[model samples]
Target: MKIIAALVTASINKPVSTTIGLLILFMLSAMTVVAEQLPPPSATTEYSKEGADTCLQCHDQDSKFPVLAIFNSPHGNKNTKHGPFSSAGLQCETCHGAAAAHTVKRLRKGQVRAAMISFKTKDVISNDEKNQLCLACHQATTTRHWLGSVHQSNDLACTDCHQIHISDDPILNKAQQLEQCGQCHTKEKVANHSVFSHPLTSGQMGCTDCHSPHDANNNQLLVSDSVNETCYQCHAEKRGPFLWEHEPVTDNCLNCHRPHGSNQAALLTQRAPYLCQNCHNSDGHPSFSYGSDDAQGQQASAFLLGRSCANCHAKIHGSNHPSGYKFQR
Candidate 1:
């Protein structure tokens, strides 16, 4: 009777001990999985490589990459100390990150993994990360205000407008810039082609002439503090501290003129007489209805004739003459 009782207790204790051991093993496995899922530390050291030649071996012109064309670009200039191909430069790895994992051959049957940074790839780093790589070198001069720029806030990458490998970037060329900008600014493209638009299609001016794509403190990415100030860059005569100031002209150029384009002549928002009527509603000649065809023909004809209000108020922008109060002189 004593032997049977001891055997029954031993059997029960053995199963409990086995269950506890299995529970411990499962917990340990779960902890190991959680540890493996944690992100690794960031790489601090650069890759061990000589030059762009190593990358060119696999990424040639025939392999969907125009690698050789980089030799014709500023980044490929080895003579310059500041260039990407200089002695201290990392060459392809400067912008592309390390190539070891990407270049090494694998025996797997599936597609090879992307081991380097790519601006065109959707699965790579975020747009900010990609732009940071370029800003690391381009933070000076023109890019100083890039942090809060319209383009930056919109998540537009530097690679979106620039071609790193090409000798001549299309965005930098005045003749080709409109097409590149037109990709995103479709409305502006249509406006630029209007009757009284700027000479953009004629190659006389470019979008960059008035705008700073990388950074600008003003709206519309203008190079100056205001819309009128930007227009004054080319139309300096219009920028004045005249003896007599037109309130609307001084406040904003866009109040009367359209900067992009207009169907009316001289970029006017509306034809004169009607354009003047919007502001001047005083009694007498200023408020006279020129459109009326009546027996008082002479007075109405004078207002409706060629040049209209401008026929008398010629110096409409502003005038310095003592008798120029009516803007006529």
Candidate 2:
């Protein structure tokens, strides 16, 4: 028994290299046991619910990705009636398609999709299909004229100037449309700011309130194209059938007036006397009148400026008098 014990002791104290090899084998066996005990891989897609988590799994800090606030928006709610999960919900995917690729790139390639998926349509598709994405909801609506509008003809994309996901976008709202429009219409802004222009600063009017955004039957997208016809809508009294008539009244209002905000009172295209003298002459004026009103009335300047022709010729439209060829009262 002693001899057997001695032999066992000797074997147990084997070479350092052999002991090290056994220790390595024991560690590998323990590792295998631990690995086998771990939970198995899940088969379900990550963040299929809400999809926000998967998207933010990468988009949390991107400055250009403005829609990230969507997660905190009313549409981001999964529990409320108006939440993204509800019937009236506004899911992130509603405007932007599934963000799977966006998330994948975030985790792997820095969140850049191979190709951009803007809402704009390209030339690759038919005209119908080219606008299919927008027409999906906007068809037969106020924007129905979009098919023939200048923007459509030029292939201008809605996303080029708008962010639809942003419900409170300044440009879309009427009160802020001017500022947005001013970004591209600097000259119009300069004209609007003239000394005698309209009250554009008071926020009572907007670009769309006067001009249509898309195509219109009117010229220059005006609510009414004909110059006089448009003015008549507002100045119905000017469409009079008085016994005396001003010849220019029959012609276009634009012949003497500037409909857009103007630098002159009454929005006149030119100051008064010169404008009136385009046809009239002072052949029947009082004996005191001498120089022509056209050249600032050197001799009768005060009379011409005050009431010379208009005061006495009140019935200038067309006098009913037996001897009034000039319609002078």
Candidate 3:
């Protein structure tokens, strides 16, 4: 402290240099503190000696904790050089860690110790620790942005969405994917069941089609740079650099349309006329009310009876026509 004080006093005449020196010292001190706080690297255990064969003895089809089904999965494919079982023949211990204590011969009939790393066990390490085991292999690929991803920040483990030992991971299957996502996103699940929703129930579309749940550069984990860009994936016709563009449509699709689902037709945030009224309250026609009484009237009643404001403004999304300034075609 005295040495730092003396240095600061000596450099007082040169404020910029003194500040820079102080910053460097602070950074070095922080680095040293961080180094001291880090835990020691774990030592290798004996469980890797016999590979999956040893684990299969106690985790066979007949055992309560059957792991033989893993043979049907891609991880069990010994033909693939990059597979867990084939790569350096690590197999079970590659994920579960070295189980030196758990594998030891039991002295008593009722004595059973825990494995080195158990995903299902309560009070193990932590979600982050469990994720590290998976990220060790995945960090280079699909999970490249996983370090600061929303799932990582929320402490979501890889096992929460993936079933490793099973022959099929439910989250990967389109038919079963929503069920897995719905476990956490209850609101989206309910929205899919709305009167006007994307064909999620029919398996025509999936959450992953729009969202990269692993990691994304956009908000809401969208696969594209923006919500409008994501919607343009399927609604390509609406992606026009038109002669006349609807301000809200060009700005954001969510301005008038709901991505998930809605009670109104065409996934509209609200029915026409009322929805258009919110934005278009011009002098006469655009501001006119479309009530039941108007049904008794003449030509104007026809617009109110059917699609309302959309009756005349058919090209409401956008228009390429030279005379489409009002988005009416």
List per-candidate RMSD values in Å: 10.4, 22.6, 5.4
Candidate achieving higher lDDT, 1 or 2:
1
- As for TM-score, the candidate ahead, 1 or 2, is 1
Candidate lDDT (C-alpha), each:
0.77, 0.57, 0.79
Show pairs that collide, candidate 2: 105-111, 106-111, 244-317, 244-318, 245-317, 245-318
Task: Give the lDDT of residue 72 in candidate 3.
Answer: 92
**Window of ten residues with lowest summed lDDT in model 1:** 39-48
Give one digit per residue, the lDDT tens place, for model 2 in 1-329.
Answer: 45445445655969987767666666686788889986422212232355555556545555455566554544455665544545654355444444444444334545544222345454223344435555655555457887777656766665555555454556656667767777767877676776665555566666666666666775466656666666676677777665666677667677767655577766767655555666665366452334554445255555554444555665544565666656675
Q: TM-scores, in order shown?
A: 0.80, 0.60, 0.82
Candidate topping lDDT: 3
* Ranking, lDDT, top scorer first: 3, 1, 2
Candidate order, TM-score descending: 3, 1, 2
- TM-score for candidate 2, residues paired by index: 0.60
- As a whole number from 0 to 100, the lDDT of residue 144 in candidate 3 is 86
Q: How many clashing pairs in candidate 2?
A: 6
The regions of model 1 sitting more than 4 angstroms off are: 1-51, 105-107, 121-123, 286-307
Model 2: CA > 4 A from native: 1-53, 56-62, 68-90, 105-112, 119-132, 241-247, 279-303, 306-329
If candidate 2 were superposed on the true structure by all CA atoms, what would the RMSD be?
22.6
